[model samples]
Target: MAVDTTPAAPSHPEGGDSGGEAVRPLLSGAPAEEEGEEEELDVRYAPYARRDAYGVMGRGPLSPAQVARLVLAAAFLLPLRLVAGVFLVVAYYLVCRICTLFVDGLEEGRPRLQGWRREAVLRAGRGLSRAMLFVFGFYWIPMSDRSVPNAEDVHQDQSAELERPGAIVSNHVSYVDVLYHMSASSPSFVAKNSVSKLPLIGLISKCLGCIFVQRESKGSDSKGVSGAVTERVQEVSQDNNSPMVLLFPEGTTTNGDYLLPFKTGAFLARAPVQPVILRYPYKRFSPAWDSMDGARHVFLLLCQVANYIEVVHLPIYYPSEQEKDDPRLYANNVRKLLAIEGNLTLSNLGLAEKRVYHAALNGNSPRALHQKDD
Candidate 1:
């Protein structure tokens, strides 16, 4: 039988008077491609995300809010550093006095005991210095990276030729270089004697087996630095510690994009001179610059300073046994090695083909301090 094909009564577009309404698209009034494009172009924000368009490492341009907050924070914290510095100095002096008395007592009628007690006092000083550094590190400085080599690796290279202690030479990028080396390895420093007069900081340096030389004053004073280095190597051997001395060959801080030629004194330290290359993620604002005036510059830096601080200990170099006595040639080879490893170009960081003495290196020069120093 032929079935009847008849249409039902028409319903309204909105399903008026019907049991259920017609289904509509979840996203209405936009084509699929258009919807996708809109989603792709959306700018998302996360709380505390780093500000964009700034240098990855150095402080970038700041907004008014950032500047205001930075000022307020500095006003709150500057006095604290001052107070801490003063307190540390007083306490360190007292401790030194007590040790001196004990050493004097030990020396009475027992000459050999005097030497032992002297070393013990020095050891205490080194420990205190390290403690101070830890305290300093906890300040608003946010370190991005500070990884050391595996203990196994540090040992393997140092052990290759155990005839004498090896020297580690690096570019002196900042005062933080000292702390960085201390944190990674216990090595004697090749430093200038002027550092010994700096109150609390000077005390810490002395404790760290720092060989202080008069960079300008010659004869005995100059010889003292090298002599101390040799003595330190002997001390390390007696203690059965890693054979290494930390040497800042550049003798000063730089932008860090280009390494300054080394000061050859470091090569005179007994050993196979190992070139230790320390690099921050950004060459401009590593904590190494922390000692620069320590007030105004730090104030500007703490206020949204570099995005991060990174220290990389590059390869260890062992100069041929022949070059140990000839420091200049030793330094030249180490510099050449670093140049090759860095693969730096003149325009790499907008640096000139040759380094020129900028006012920054001069102690009396007006610094890039944000606030005027009266």
Candidate 2:
């Protein structure tokens, strides 16, 4: 029987796949070949073979010494890390609760803690978040700030009217990305609505003034979220004291090796944004959140004796006249810059391709899912 090597159609939603570019298919596996025929697979699809993004499955089986090391780490380090991590989290939650006390309308409108209360929360949050990362074995983080000075400073042209940096945009790789950002700059994030209901995190997220949205909704609900983000971006640009809004233009996590197509919501306001790039250089297990479950990722991360992270802070990106008018152009241009500077491959795949890859990896048919919709 001839093997079917045809690529499945990507099922991306509107506003998800930017630029309407043709996305390379996310292949689950290579087709079977005849007895003596050598199979040649494209290197691009190597990341998708294991059904998870970032090719954790492709890392192959562990060596005997590696297994012994993991065993020892699991026996000793895991317990200490767990206890310390939990303690730090609970302590931080108490601090947030106290800081938010007597402050009304926090649960209602856009929560912005002012004066001493804001300072208290930001300081405590940053300290505790760093402690938590330390407990997880991120002892030291090396950061590179390659950002250029503001155009206004370089050129004495008041007529230019360059926008101030309103938001910090970065590619999402793992949940750990939030901790680093919190410690670096306590900026508000764009998070899922469900995150607001999570036990310890929900309250903390609200205190950080996280903009919540339903990720699954594609109708007017999404548009409302976009408008809210734009308004917040504008507010940040105008108010020097407002917390910088942090947005992940990719809208989802990847393996940290590829940059996905960006969603235009972050660029809708056309405000200047500080682009940040985060990388996890690991020898054994990767810290990227692409295909791993939260529990397993955390457990493995703690099991390791040490972990490494590199953060690159690029210069503030101000949109040009044409880019300001076209949000897509602005988003794509930023994505391209990140890809080149970060040495990450540019992928046309978006959230939809990720879902399809996940489903196929787990023994489900993506075509069947699409068939039901049809």
User: Among these predicted structures, which one has the highest TM-score?
Assistant: 2
lDDT string for model 2 (95-145, tens) is 778888888866763556788888888998899989888988899999999
Clashes of each: 2, 1
- State the weakest 10-residue window (summed lDDT) of model 2: 34-43
Write model 1 residue lDDT over 1-374, tens digit each, in one string. 11112211111211111222121211223467655422321111000011122221123454576557667756865556556646755776565545455333222221122354445544554555555444444322333232233445444545554444466666655565665566555566766677766765565455444666776776656467667666665455445443357766665554344455555666665455555555434312234342235554454444333323344445555555556567678777777666555432111111121111112222222223212332
Task: List TM-scores for all candidates, in order.
Answer: 0.55, 0.82
Segments in model 2 whose C-alpha atoms lie over 4 Å from true places: 1-60, 150-162, 216-220, 366-374
Q: Which stretches of candidate 1 lie over 4 Å from their true place?
A: 1-63, 84-97, 104-161, 164-166, 191-205, 216-245, 282-295, 301-308, 314-316, 337-356, 359-374
lDDT of 1 at 344: 23
**Residue 189 C-alpha lDDT in model 1:** 72
Candidate 1 pairs with clashing backbones: 174-288, 175-288
